[model samples]
Target: MTKLRIGIVGCGSITKYRHAPEYAHNDAVEIVAFCDPNVERATLMAEEYGGKVYADYLEMFHNEELDAVSVCTPNLYHAPISIAAARAGFHVLCEKPMAASEADALRMIAAAKDSGVILMVGHNQRLMPAHQKAKEVLLVGDLGKVLTFRTAFGHPGPESWSADGKESWFFQKDIAIVGAMGDLGVHKADLIRWLLDDEVVEISAFVETLHKEDTEVDDNAICIMRMGKGSIGTLTASWTYYKGEDNSTLLYCENGVIKIGTDPVDQVIVERTDGTIDKYDVGAMSTNTGQTHSGVIDSFIYSILTNTPPAITGEDGMKSLKVILAALESAASKTLVSIH
Candidate 1:
């Protein structure tokens, strides 16, 4: 079997903790190149992954015969980098939020289509055992007729993850565009869209700089959404959680209410009309094993080997990006925004 040669474009925490290590374990992938403006970071990653290092991504694409590449760069670079990779005749697995703007997202999509390369997005949450189980339960009607979705995600900030801590690009509007909404809300939005199997048709939102003493972007945001099927929902994202990660969702339906999140205590809780609450440790069914990278990487490898579309595609990324961007627009304008 010919292993797909992969070139990774960023040497950040995500690349270190997620993509690179996952590809290392996958039998179907051979990471052949790594690039980062910081030579030390690039060199370190290359040494660990047994890949050549390059300071410029363009140079990596020119030198390596890659089958695919992961765009793990910042929001602004995502479109241009992925487009360049697609034109280089390599498939793409870009990090989430797609791009800084809708126009950029569309341009990347066009480039991928023009290049005839598979463009998958790194919405890793979709591959989680808990999320996958929730999707299954909802899709299979186990939750009965879905009525509403209330989701929230908050975790202090990415200071611990970035090289520069609070001084990281995440705190700069020029570099990150927006704060919590861009950094974290995108994932929650994508998950809600996927689990509901519905498009967000309209949105009203507000974003404020409730924290992060030095940043110009909002540290928190709250959004209200109306899905295509008339289901109403609420989404909350913040960089204000004192400690620990919290990404959870609750769905109210005709027959029961389902709750899901990253809780060692409980994953899925279903409340029935009989006044009996059933609890399911959905994480126990995990192929996850507290290892999201492995599961996502395995899925990517399977998709490529089977010549099948990824569970999260560029199109899927764009749809979710639209909602996030629209929320930003709505927050700025202080009005409801149409998502069409």
Candidate 2:
């Protein structure tokens, strides 16, 4: 079997903990190159992963022959790097908040289409066992119509998770674009959209830098969203969740409610209007403190090997990004923003 050659851009905490290890575990992939502006980081990854290090992604693209590339850089670099990789004929698995803007995301989609390569977004929330189970339960129609929902993704901030710690690009408005909203909110947005199989038609939000000091971007955000299917919900993303991580979602339906990521033993809980409850111990969710296999890398590789559309396509990414962008607009205008 000719293994898929992989090139990884940005040797940050995500690459270290998620992308690199996941790719390494896959028998179908061979990581061929690593690129980061911080050459030391690239070098360290290369030493473990058996790849050549480059300070520039373009240089890596020029030097190495790769089948796919993971864009793990800060939010601002996603579009440009993914575009370059796609145009170079490499499949892309870009980190969430696909790009700084919707326009850049569309350009990335265009680049991938023109190059005939897959472009997958790293919205691993959709791949979580509990989330998948929840979607399955919804699809079964046993829960009846989903009326209201609430999803949250919060942690102690990226300072503890990023490679640069306190100096991480996550705090920089120029690089991160939106702090908690981009880092955590986008994941919930993507997850909710996928779970409900509906788009957010309208949104109103309060995005502010509430807790973290010295950050140019927001530390917390609360968004009220109305899905196209008429379901209303709230999405919360916060960096001030200093005690522990909270990645949970609740969907209230006519029948009862479905809760996800709430119980450690039972990751997915379903309650019926008849006052009966069921629990699923699929697995634990991946958190900053307790990392689990995200299943994103394997799915990306499956799409490449099978020549199928990625589970999370660039279009899906763009749609999810639009929600966060709309939330930002709603925050700034102090009014409801509608998604077209």
Best by lDDT: 2
Per-residue lDDT value at 320 in model 1: 92
TM-score result, candidate 2: 0.99
Cα-based lDDT for every prediction: 0.84, 0.95
| Tens digit of per-residue lDDT, candidate 1, span 26-119 | 8888999999999899899988889899999999999999999999888889999999999999989898878988899899999989988888
Instruction: Let me know the TM-score candidate 1 reaches against the reference structure.
Output: 0.95
In angstroms, the error of model 1 at 319 is 0.8
Q: What is the lDDT of residue 197 in candidate 1?
A: 83
Clashes found in each candidate (C-alpha, N, C closer than 3 A): 0, 0
Give the total clashing residue pairs for model 2. Answer: 0
lDDT of 2 by residue, 161-215 (tens): 9988998899999989999999999999999999999999999999999889998
Q: TM-scores for all candidates?
A: 0.95, 0.99
